[model samples]
Target: MHRLEQQFIDNQWVRSRGARYLPVMNPYREEVLAEVTAGAPQDVDDAVKTAQRALPAWRSLGGAKRATYLEGFAAALTRRREALVRLSSTNNGKVLAEAAIDLDDAIACYRYYADQARRLDERQGAAVSVEMANVEARCYHDPVGVVGLITPWNFPLVTSAWKLAPALAAGCTAVLKPSEVTPLPEQALAEIALEIGLPSGVLNLLNGDGEGIGAPLSRHAGIDKISFTGSNRVGEAVMAAAAERTVGVSLELGGKSPILVMEDADPEQAADWVMAGIYFNAGQICSATSRLLVHEAVADSLYSALEKRIDALVLGNPLAEQTDMGPLANARQRETVNGYLATAEQEGLRVVRDARHRQLPSRGYFVAPTLYRDVPLTSRLWKEEIFGPVLCGHSVANEQEAIALANDSDFGLAATVISGDGDRARRIGRELRAGSIWFNSEQLVLPETGWGGFKRSGIGRELGPWGLSSYLEVKHVIGPSHG
Candidate 1:
């Protein structure tokens, strides 16, 4: 039984004032891995104040100095790569390969931001050419200051890295609230900071649920920005709370992204990509392609191939090297997925695969990958974001029908077009109302590209230069030229 019951505040591991403790469970084993302090509003205040105090000095260090710290953080992560992979797999119930990939992505993200930070002031800045004579105007990019980073449990370290690395790169101090389910990795990052002798109060971490810490952090006046990645409902609450102080907020919310398979696409290839998209990370990804719009000519063949590929998936311990899929992150998530399964059954959708046909470990929260076809357009199975390893497929007669069906949803986070014809794929990709679109392939997010959505999916991007901009405040400095 691991007991890690403390919050990292002002560069110190301090015991919480609150008495409650939240258990961090190994989702695959359904056992308590560790217990973390359930921080209260006072703890949130402490973290925010610490971050606020540290901001001025951190920003004054400028981009070059900040880059060195970020590079140090990246090196620290590299040294702890193996431990981080094991922790992520055990705590989050992701396959070992996925966990390793998550760490690698985080390391790359930090390094990318380190490079960006080194060149932030040099490569990018605004020096306007004014129309009026003897008038010289320039703009400066300044840190947003004391940002409150709230990341979800799905991809704990990677998501937090997206916010933290960029915030640090932009020369901002932050108070991070990792999900109560998986706060270990974020805490581990703080531990590395401590080991590297990072300045006090530059990066603080508070661990708690939404009610205990999230609300207070969002509404805190000392927090100049709130960068959040979670459910849309909570994101709305964060936005509303931040409105109280007019604080800057960047949210990467929920998604019900879809993929379109053209008639020209190979059924086998389409099946493989679609399976990977929906089942990777157990379909917990916000940009997951959960909805598939297939051309009628190839729908039957593609669906059959997908069923065969999905059946070949191995589900077991995340630590096991051969396990292709692991359990849901927690029992609650299993229940939620089961609820959706029941709804799909009631709606009379064609269930291609589910847990009823498979044997799973009785001890943990496990849900078999499911594929539903001929789903009603109005059913929740088609509209709601299940956020589990479930796919809802629809058949479209032509390209026009496919595009229309794909764009019918309230979400526009991501869409993919699979076609043999590159020209046709490019044309269709342009018509999809999503932030990210792929042609003939689907994989993980690239750090250099922007990642966000339209409509209810999300408000702002979270990676690349766009992500760095989210943590910065731009100001126009106008003065008379004494030439």
Candidate 2:
């Protein structure tokens, strides 16, 4: 039991005013890992005030100078990479390899955005109509003052790092509230930020439920922009809160992403990737390929191959080196996945693999992976974001039908098209409404590519230059005639 009790506000660890607090549970061991205070609406006021106070100077800092601090932060993270990996594995219930990769990704996000901030600046002007040379035309990428960030629990460290690194890179002071389920890492970052000379109040960390800290943060008048990653329902709530203040909002929401397997695709390779697409992180990823639609001609072979590979995967303690899969994050998540499995059976979908109830040590939460076939396009398991180790395979008559099925969902977060033919791959990838389309691959997030969703999936995006730009507001400046 690690005792950590502090709210990093204005660059110092402070105690919470609200009497409410919660236990931070380690999903791998189902033990009380830490005691965290639940920040209240009033605490949000302090955080926003702190960010507001730090904004002017922080935003005015030059790129090279900002890079110096970021470099220190990055180096600091590198030195503690091993501890981060262990904490991530213990808390997130992810395989150590996966947690290790998440930490590396955080480092990569920082290095990439640090460089971007140096190269890009908006305080200057640019060329316009040459005939009107006397006049000056320029665009500005100014910070949005205080940025409010609320990240999900699945990839708590990496995802929060996504918003924090870029928001800082853009010179925006931030008030970040990590999900209660996984707030330790973010709180830890708060400590590191203070030591790295992140500047008082430039970054604030709080722990609380959505109704407490998140709602207040979004609706806070001092917040100039909001960035959130969560379910569509919660995303809607945060957007509504931001709307109340008329602040800019960015979201990375729910996804029912599909993976299409073409007839010519390699069954050996495609099967493994498809299984990974839905099973990695125990299918909690927003971009997890929950739906698998294959060409009719190859559906049988592909399904069989996937079943064989998935069955051999090891699922147990996340700490073990041989563990390829781990338990759901908590008992509630386990119940949710189990409930979805029950519903899939009642909905007349054929459960190709009936998941067995596995017992874990009195310490942890665990669930066996599952695969369902013969599911109607409208089935709950097919259309909903299960956020667990469940995959539903459906047969498509042709490429066109596959594309239609992929687009049928209200979500448009991501899709994967597996095909040997470049033309067909391009066509399907293009037609998919998802923000991201993976072709002949899976489970890899690219730094340069833009990522977001359409419809109810999300607003704006995160990752790459796109993610960085979300923190900055565009402004046009006009100068008096020169010559």
Best by TM-score: 1
Taking all chains together, the TM-score of candidate 1 against the true structure is: 0.98
Which residue pairs come into collision in candidate 2? 29-363
TM-score for every candidate vs. truth?
0.98, 0.96
Per-candidate clash tally: 0, 1
Q: What TM-score does model 2 achieve against the real structure? A: 0.96
Question: Which tens-of-lDDT digit does each residue in 405-451 have in candidate 2?
Answer: 88999899989999989788988899989888888776678667777
lDDT of 1 by residue, 1-483 (tens): 777677899889898766788899999878998997777899998888888788889998888888888888889999999999998998999998999888889888999999899878694456788899998888789998889999999999889889999999998998989999988877788888888888899999888888788998998889899999999999999999999888888988888988899999999999988987899999888888999999999999999999899889999989999999999998898899899988877878888887667888777788999988877789898898888999999899999998998999889899889999999999998999999998888765888999999999888888999999998888887878884
Model 2 scores worst on lDDT over the 10 consecutive residues at 121-130
Off by over 4 Å in 2: 130-133, 357-363
Off by over 4 Å in 1: 123-126
Per-residue error at 345 for model 1, in Å?
1.3
